[model samples]
Target: MAGLLAAMTVSLTGTRVSAIALPWFVLTTTGSPAQTGVVAFAEMAPYVLVKALAGPLVDRVGPRRISWVGDVVSATAAGTVVLLHALDLLPLGALVTLVAVVGAARGPGDLAKEIMIPEAAERGRVPLERATGLMGVTERLAQTAGPAAGGAMVALLGPLAGLAISVTCFALGSMIVAWALPRGMGHSAPAQEAPEAGQKGQEAGQEGYWRRFGQGFTFLRGEPLLLSVVVMVGITNLLDAAFSQVLVFVWARESGHDAAVVGLNSSVAGATAVGGSLVAAAVAHRMRRRPVFFVAFLLAGPTRFLVLAVDAPVWAMVTVFAVGGFAAGFLNPILGAISYERVPRHLLGRVNALRDSLAWAGIPLGGLVGGAAVVAAGLTPVLLAGGAAYALTTSLTGLRPEWRQLDRPRRTGPSVVPAPRERAGTTDGGRAERSP
Candidate 1:
């Protein structure tokens, strides 16, 4: 667990830093908001596409192996960008290509690491809620530290230096996973064949990749609760992408604070999130899932955009984001616990991949849409519209029937009744009696 957390921290921190550096670099270099959106789209489009497809492979090959390979690939891709830029050989086309490669590698890598958490938590004998809360802590802390570091580096040494540091982090993360953990840690036994259905020719052969994919989709189809969660998460993620990738960037430029203010705001939000996750980890199980989740979304979503929509001081912006971030921290632990409890362990990889991919499918489009929207409608209007949309979506979704599942206890069935001894023909003395 330590090794996994450490590796995740390092890898995610670097990624977050790069997330800041990449856009700032684009905004500064190209000076076209549309191109900033284009680069963001180029990277994440492949991320969603590859992640949707990599689940079967992650399950078959084992997550640990895949995780290490993904980190190595990310490191290589990041390093290539650094080297090419240093050598003056990187054009916009080449840069986009490399970023896309990094994104593709990260999709499987991040998913593989996520798949390891349940196993890790089980081995540690920690409650799934607490374990996932701790996971949230790690992520929040990384988000806290990464942007601050990235901003500092970009401010001092330029964007290339931040990219260089990102490569180093990825390399170190790969090494930690490769060398620090025991072998076969996250590997699973071969997947069992699915039961034959009545359909002609479908049951005659080993299941193909598409068949396995179908199995996951079929499983989700039966789960209305999970489906509702997925849709809600997808819409929120889209709004979040718009805010983070485009709206925030444009606002920073307009506000004339740029990287420093962006980093400061992001860091504060992340730092507060760490505290929130800690509180959640300690008390989440004792709390009701529904109201807590709904209220958190209400507090976290839309408020940031709405605050940023008007002219406000930097402190006001920070305060709003901090409130949002703190509320946001409690969310994933609940969601993760629910997901881990509901899904079969063997299908974790495929099901998680499918769910996450569908949820994240809107992200690439977010940057594209935000950029185009800004070009068409301008920044403040876009921010206003986004906030209103977030509020409406979250509010409307709370009224859903399926959303009630979040409030239910983890065990859905009635308590088991004790069998009568006479019915079993057994004595209370624990001896079997002869039947007449």
Candidate 2:
């Protein structure tokens, strides 16, 4: 499990690099943050929408196959972008279309990876907390390594060329998944050779594609904790969406600097996040979850706003991002573990989809909202709003009864009276009893 995750981490580093490079490239090339934001929205919108739709597909096709397909698609898409750029015909519309495809593919890939953790571990080789911790660590490592690598790659080869490396990494990761997996009719469907009656009967037992798809919605509606968490998270995410894309380039423009300077800021955030991921891996299980969630949320908002509020030195902004990234690092694993532990495995896809969809639900609005925010009060006010929203949402949610207590083991069934033993099954000594 660790090996798979570690290998996959390399692929994610490619993704991380692209995240930095793509926005910087878009903003610089167009000289418009709004356009940069449009690229972000196009990518993220499909990601959010398709991820929700694709979750059940992961469960159905089984994680390994879905993962491979997603990776391959993403790799191909990335390579296409590179090709377009090399040809010098990479229009903004074309870029948006390509990124949207990548986002769509990534939805399945990410979902499959998340589902595989519990499945790969099976009964007891890996515990949820520990596995999730390691996942956090993997992500952190990517965060730390990705930006600098991306920056260096872009510097040496240019942004379009960087995609070639990313494509290679993703393809390699997919190959790793393709070859290594346990097989035997995964995804809980009837064998293809089943009799007609058996097939009909099975169809009744399991939902068709459309029916199964709708169940994702039903599942979310049935669960209160899931709904609450997603809603609050969605709120904060909306606030974040407003500034996440244009941060570095906007900052550089505001400070009268260059694109390279923007990369430096992104690299700092990635570095700090890596440290936080390691810490999360080490201490996640020992820590009570509620407090951790609350405190992290509380810290994230203010740190984000503060970074934008003051016209401090570059290092000062970097410091703020470091703090914010640290807080951000702890969130996903904690929430993922929560979902894993509490939600039933069969419904994991829909649940994940619902949560992810909600979290990303605010993304489309980012371009419009971010543009407005930048125009009205400058980056500082926008950052401040994001921060305040982050803190306020977390604090309020912490007061909920369900989230107040840390997660623990759950009872599986109602208690029943114990049946009397049959004369102790057999007497062994002076207190011997007759057998039936």
Top TM-score hit = 1
Q: Model 2 residue 175 lDDT?
A: 78
Q: Candidate 1: global Cα-lDDT?
A: 0.76
State candidate 2's TM-score: 0.81
lDDT values for all models: 0.76, 0.65
- Tell me, what's the RMSD of every candidate? 10.7, 11.5
The prediction achieving the highest lDDT against the true structure is: 1
Instruction: Compose the digit string of candidate 1's lDDT tens values, residues 1-436.
Output: 7788888889988888898788888788789877887788788888778988887777667789989999999999999988887798888999899999999998889888877887788677877778778878877887778877898899999887888889988999999999976685877413222222333223322346776666667766667777777878888888887888789999988877777787678777778888888988888978988899889888888898898889689889899889978888888888777777766655666777888888876766777799899999999999999999999987898888777767663432112111111111000000000000
- Which residue ranges in model 2 land beyond 4 Å of their true spot? 20-40, 83-96, 184-205, 246-265, 310-319, 378-381, 409-436
Model 2 poorest 10 in a row by lDDT: 427-436
